[model samples]
Target: MSFNNLMIYRHPCIVKYVSSWQKNCKFYLAVEEVTPLSHVLPLLNTLQICVGLHSILKALHFLHEKASVSHNNICISSIYVTRDGSWKLGGMEYLCRYEDLSSDFLNKSRMNRYFKAVDSNEEKVFVNPTARRDFIDVYAFGVLVYEVFKSRESFDEVPNLDVFCDYCRNELQHTDPSQRPILSSILKHDFFNHEFINIHSFLIELPLKSDEEKMLFFRSLVGRLKMFNEEVVASQLGNLLLSRMVLLNGVAQETIVPFLLTPKSDEQEQTDQLFSEDTFKKYISPKLLEIISVRDAQIRLLLLNNFSNFMYMFTKEELQMYFLPELLVGIKDTNDHLVSVTLRTLADLVPVLGAATVIGGKRAKLFNDGRPMAHSNKNLPKEGTPQENEHPVVRDQILNNSISSIIDSHNLILPERSRPDGEEVETSTEEIEQSVDEDLENWDDWDLNENHSILINRLGIADIIEDSNDIAENHSNEGIKSIVNTKGDLARSKKTIADIEELDIKSQVQNNENDSFDFFHDMEPVINSSSKFLINEDNKCDVSLGIDKEVSSKLALNVNDINEEGWGDGDWD
Candidate 1:
């Protein structure tokens, strides 16, 4: 029979063989062995269901368009499972026209037997026998999805079956068969949404519940969904499970706000109460961070976008020390979405950590390595050059450490200036130059003093001239007259005379010009010593200068003593 050959070749799941073949027969009769629905249902999961449903929909579309055929028997029962678990629609007995059949007597008998209950009904149903059969098959498929959500026997005794059947009947009552809602609608019913509700609140309310129970429940749900549909499992089941775990871990306070603000009235309030920001920060952040470290770009992007919305929950210290490095690494990702999310998280964190610290530190590192800005300047190399191959991690650590040292030093020095009436005095260039010149003048006066005279001052004449000019320009007649009246000018003159004598002695002795120190080097010690005293207006400077003169006199005496006590071979102190 033509139908038998077509069914055998097209429906691989049909294993039974026809006993005899009749030529010129419009219909083929075949006995096919099929795996029972009970055995097959256990193997179906959300992924398999999705794949199977998609395949069937495509097949149905092809049949309707290309083959000019419609599967009137499209129920799960009519769909046979192969050894490898894939499904194919097997029973096609209802697809042929009356004229295509060889045995009209047998066909009538079958119609009478099958339509007897329908024929007995008094009310006229919108009955095209062909269309009715197809509608019935679609209605049965809807029931299959309903059964999946319920997770019960397909035809078990249940009080809810009557209500469900009534709903299906109402939905299938559309005048145009094609206008009925497709299988996708039936699969995604609001009731099913309620059934697949997030269980976060249950764990929270019952804190004493065993972790084993939670894990069992979670693993079971995820396993089932993963088997049936991986994307659905990832987005719906996996996310829900992660959300619950995150909530239970006390980090939900951060993440739960958006959901709470738009509470689903259909879901229980207790469930809604479980979500919070703290749960998100504590549980979700770490989990996502872990995922980001290991997972592929696609998965990492998915997790990152979901996690980034509540980045404000992380503290500045946490973000800088922990999250920022990971976020920075993500900038190299090829996925535009991931790069955008990583940058957005950084943007949100910048205000919290102080933009200067985060962005400035990044900029500093980029500049150090000669890399262009992450966002700007496309002509710049993305990767570092050989010379610039220094690791950012080590550099960042060193920079942070250096910053800490600076902060500590600042703190240590800040208290000294925190006087109640202390106004910050801004140092002017003129004041600094005046101070330097005063020190130089003091050194000159010290050189003229016999008691304070040294052997080697070697002061720069050019610097002395520069100092004299600076002093002349800054010091008014009134300031100099006041200084001279206080015995300050005499003391300054004495120091300058001592300094000049020391310079004369050094210049007279140094014959090796090429090996000799420069004028700045020779005079630097004297200038530094004098500058400290000149900078301050306190009496300590005068006292320090007197002590310096005394120390110089003592050093001269000690040198004489050593020379006089010499026993010719070695000097004895």
Candidate 2:
């Protein structure tokens, strides 16, 4: 019967009866947790007392005026305060529906021991069976107010509660139930007219209000929201603003959500923030995230547009897990504005999400992939320690060695070429001179007398002089004059060859003076020098022959030719 009455006669000011069950033959009634007003009475100030008393009056009014039932047990013990500090009436065991007096209902009786208030037969409001049932609750309501204020040392302790004190003294506690004020009349007193109390009452009845009324209320509420206590906004107004039953329009929601986010304005120094840090984390942050997660793009945009205001309130883990994933949805949204804002918001989030997760591939290896560090053979080998023998050989050495081999084989005196700058190539010159000296020293030991005739025949030099002698005898002056000019041309050719410093393989030294003796330069220096001596000694002819001067001159010119052959022509052939 008690559960039925609670469930049936529901009001915001009445205790909410949730569910009931039987387990192991034990009956369980599940309801919201609450603290009785009696438990928190000492803690109540003037404003708290007024708000609590106001909530109870509304509950009693619901019973008497609306439901036509009587809460025969209205008292401080029966009033329960929820977590948000809103007061609710809970003691319904003694409630009676006078209009429904079936036999089964009539058998229900009120237990006298539990009735906190003393009753008398003289008072019709309490005992007269035929009396108005509402009068009983109204009188009990008065007693509840009196007991609350009377608990204080003096009425002066509470300032604005004078109206409540006066009403409790004269009207509600009146002996005649007809003279006592109605619940609606008592609610109009100054004590119940506080901003916090009115806001609370409006939220309690918010569900039944028209959308237009709610919009006006919420729009007007924007400025007035900060006037209420933070605890009230956090607990009551937050849930009420978001309640689906309220059917709040988008504008109404948009208006209220910011107030919930920053419950206190910048003007208040008493507390710069109304809700504590914990309140923002456990309460405000989750609410903002929930609003962001909603599919309504406008609502998501609203939260995202003001994300900075709420983002810091969320912890790091919540930002990554809840906030980032929801934001990614906006990035993928078809709305261009939403996607743009989402990308911009993500750019701002880089510091929080980090470059690895945002710009770079997060799971990618930043450096080496832990494979053994080894050089690949695909590329040319890197420059290593330079080789010791890497320096190039001098050109002089190769040229000089080749000339030396030909000189040794042909038994000749080859001319030594100079450097490119017309300076002598000192190394090659020294090597050639050393080889010539060795050959000359070897020749000095030879038997010149025995080998002289054989050497002349072998060289074919005798044939060359015989031809020159024959030509001189036939045209002596012309031959002698042509040879003089030819000798000059030969000397000029050698000087020009040295100036150019080039090796020419087919160099032919042509002398009009003596072409026959040109091959004389091909013989070794020792052989050429000794040719005249050998001929002068071995032949023993010609002091008066008149061709001796020409013969001697021819031999001298032949030795010069042999010397020029070694170096003037570079040909190995």
Best by lDDT: 2
lDDT, residue 404, candidate 2: 32
**Which residue runs does candidate 1 get wrong by more than 4 Å?**
1-36, 97-136, 143-169, 173-573
Clash counts for the predictions, in order: 41, 8
lDDT of each: 0.41, 0.56
lDDT of 2 by residue, 119-196 (tens): 332243434457565666676777777778776765553346766777776877676777777778878877777776
The TM-score values for the models, in the order shown, are 0.24, 0.53
Candidate 2 overall lDDT versus native: 0.56
Q: Residue 558 of model 2: what lDDT?
A: 40
State the displacement of the C-alpha of residue 307, model 1, in Å, after optimal TM-score superposition.
Answer: 39
Query: Which lDDT value does model 2 have at 487?
Result: 32
